[model samples]
Target: EDCPHREKNGWMGDAHLAAEMAFYNYDVAHGYTKWLADIADEQRPSGEVPGIVPTAGWGYFFGNGPAWDCSLFLIPWYTYLYTGDVSIIEKQYPSIRRYIDFLATKANEHHIVAWGLGDWCPAKTETPAEITSTAYYFKGAEILSKMATLLGDSGSATRYAQLAEDIKASFNRQFYRGNGIYGNGSQTALACALYQGLAGEYLTETVDALVNLVKSNNYHLDCGILGAKYLINALLDNGHADVAYRIVSKRTYPSWGYWVEQGATTLWERWDGENSRNHPFFGDVGAWFYKALGGLRIDEDRPGFKHVNLNPIFPEDLDWVDVHHESRYGNIKSSWKREGKHIHWEVNIPNNTTATVFLPLGRQGEVREGGKAIRQSIARINIIRETDDMKVIYLTSGEYTFTFVNDQD
Candidate 1:
């Protein structure tokens, strides 16, 4: 149920968006895996997946678009990423390919498939539904290609890879113009293009335009439900963490802070609190705090957290952040604080696990671990790389304290 008081439907899009945060915050593998099985069982013969699994037969007749149907691919893919369990992918592969093939049948002459709910909720935007829908189509194909490669299905991998490339070319040809311009110049359209890797050569330009779009909106998000989840990440990935931080920390109408200001104890279904005040769909931003601000990430190559990556981003406005997660391997920890021009970072990597810690540094010779300068020959520590912005260090499982000075004034 999206909310206890409202229509208690199992909306697929909401589940897709909230899956990451749910896995990160809790152990939901058993329940979620069962739900995926139900979704697979309910898939219609026409290759159309219902927008809500275990449906009352309402979502099938309508609202079953790529944005809604994408849970078929995303949920299992994310499960594989988080848990390192390939059984879900193996089980869902047929249904996943069937859904993608169904979407292919909906493609226009340009090979851009577009038929779905663009961005649910009311917002001022000139972006078309086709852009968002087709972008998701491409995203699904891309993920499927990766899944095939992972499963050693070389033929399927090649097929889906080619399909993804074709879709990317079609998307760029249909929407992208010279520079950063996209269809309707809407934030959602641009975000999809950038975040979905459809921007190609125009990535930097698109990012700059996106930053300007947010600044033009006074640092307020302009995307609705579907695009909102990607907006913060797109901004942060494109060298605009400052803007991302500002948006998440804003306290006004159409912002998360607005809900907090209204004395609401939970994330609202709508940004305006127009409907159910307790919904977790739009709460994907919480994952960003853990990834970007708190700087804890599971290594994709070593999924199930066999290898941890500690890359904390210390925002200028934030003084300190503390984060911990209990992985199947062991407990992972990262705590950091800034006092004047110096930063104190403490990290704990569990036994039998290793980590690559990226410590922000202002200049060379500014980093010291356990009161000793980091060196290539240091025991259990190896300096991977050094740039003006950060010092990347590789460490075996152990507790370590590092200090660096901010030389920039």
Candidate 2:
């Protein structure tokens, strides 16, 4: 009864869970797709989806509003990218388009979409603009624009792209505080803008900012399990792949795994670095663990057999890893073991696609999978799986992985 904010459905938790499921287990495709549908059902006519559905009890968090609504727009694109189902995009297009239109109405002369009320709106005041909010806004609009183009809605595409560009320009002009740094929405906004390609020519600067954010632990404390997961993704996407890998693998107290290792069935709200169970932001920490650690990416661009880079930076003491993911294309299970001389790698990619597997860097060798001798060239190989068959590639020494369902193959 105390959870007046979210009751109708576990909105915040569900979004994070959807990302977890979509990335970790391939079997949950139907359930994940249905979850997105359920969310669309609750969307207000005004294009504002509450952070917490009334049915779920929790309405929204204190720091921000509308900022989370942008995730609603991302859900459909995430699904379509995996299933390659133009139908999903078509089904969600009208609603998404309407939402974008609504956001445009909210935009100021600067084309910057304002976050709701005082939530994260610059020093937590009633400022008209905020970097974090606009970052998500532009990023979402850009994705929607791409989806619109894919759906042949040139008008919507142009409109959304223009809006996205406007927001990006505004973000660079306003949020960037010099020294290749950014503020507002913490590093989360900075990373999202860059990873989503809204950073333009400033990718390196944005990437540097992301590194600085992680180093400074800005979002780390402000984030709960869910926020940390998203933060990790932003780092990985913006050329900080190595740092992202460290955040995932680090087992020190207060880490993602630390909570799981403490005999907790689900993820804890706060890390040991923060408060314990009494923390106000507590939800499901287990959800974020599998998602970020499993390296399950929700991409809107690749429809079949999406690109996966198996680069995990584990501590010297911690080595082996195994993960299984269920996608719209099908199921993929990957395993990696660090042998003294080489990494024993095995990947089972399902039917109807090809996987470009990257052999360990600097290592040289040929391995077999799907009943064929995988050719090793330039320390990487493209393993193409047609139908129910599989494709496997071997690696030498150093570090390496593959990009499955990529544009190249």
Candidate 3:
């Protein structure tokens, strides 16, 4: 439902984001595949994808933007990523290309496509609509290029790659101002720039400004629909996981916990209970829990469960985290706990699958697997690399319990 008091339709933006979690949490391939077909059937003759599938035909006349139109590219791309199914791309390729072409028609002389919803609902923001739309435009091109390459369409792949680079150059030249400043210092603008790699040489300054913006807001998120999905990951990538956790754990106004505190059993359409009480668009934080905190990642190169990435980040505030994802291959589990000065991490990789585990030891040298020391002579376990704080190990399918002392103390 858009709102309990308003229309209840399957909006593209909500479904696109919600689909991310569904693909991870449950077996949604069958239903999601059908939905993708339905969305394709609903496409207009002009190649405009509606904002809401099975609509009364309102969004097509208006309201559709890069953020909304991107569902076409995103759903199939994400499906391929999770299931390793190329047929979805094969079926949707033509429509996806047509839609991007439609978007190209909307671009101004500078290749800046700026006509869509920008950060739909934040209490306050300084990011502009042009920035959000153009950034997403760039993202769509980037994903389409990948999809083209995967489908063996070399010409389309090269074309989309060039298109993506052009969009990025245009976006940076128009929006970025050398330092952490982007179109009036809006959190959404800076976060989008950082998330999309549009900041270029200004990445460091942009990240610092983003952290300061979050800190200034008392560790609360100040983004809307467009920026919310990328903000947490951007923070995590830039060595700000602590800040991400703090924002997630925040229980005050305008936060996820705040909604839960207000008796929300499901995600709300807005930060405040001003509209629909049941919405999944803003509930992307659930994916962050499993991906960032639990550290269960599906390798893009090895899409599906063929190769799993276990890089759980143990926040100093949390004692332990347990996460299990049932991939197309099988069930993958990652659980870690701190007992005194030792960190015990246990992982379960499904049969016929391999995993790369990154265990945090914090400079402690003693590491063991199944009560046996992990050394260069180990047959099944390969110590890929050892940094100052973590050990990276490559392993085949099996249940393994690794123990190491956290030398931080």
Worst 10 residues of 1 by lDDT: 118-127
- The predicted structure with the larger lDDT, 2 or 3, is 3
| Candidate 1 local lDDT, 1-409, one digit each (tens) | 5767777788888888888888778887777789889888998776888888878688886877988889899989888877778898999999998988989888887777667776876345545789888988999999999999988999999999999999999888888876687898878888888877888888999999888888999998877877788788788777787788999988987788888899988988777788788787887898888888877876878887778788877777789998877777777888888898788888888898899988876754478888887773359998899887778889898888888885544
Go through the candidates in order and give each one's C-alpha lDDT: 0.83, 0.53, 0.83
Quote model 1's TM-score: 0.95
Residue 65 shift from truth in candidate 2, angstroms: 3.4
Clashes of 1: 0
lDDT of 2 by residue, 74-134 (tens): 6566566656667667777777777776777777777665665322212111223355466
* Residue-by-residue lDDT tens digits, candidate 3, 1-409: 2545567777788777677788878887777778788888988767778888777777886667888778788888888888888888889888888888888988998889878766787756646788988987898889989998988999999999999999998888898776687776777888888888788788899999989989999998888876788788788778887788898899998799999899889888778877777778887788889888888877999998789888877776678888898887788998889897787888899899999988777555778888888884347688899887778989998888888886655
lDDT value, residue 163 of candidate 3: 95
Residue ranges of candidate 1 with Cα displaced over 4 Å? 363-365, 376-378
RMSD of each: 1.7, 7.5, 1.8
Candidate 3 lDDT at 231 equals: 85
Better of 1 and 2 by lDDT: 1
Q: What are the TM-scores, per candidate, against the unseen true structure?
A: 0.95, 0.72, 0.95
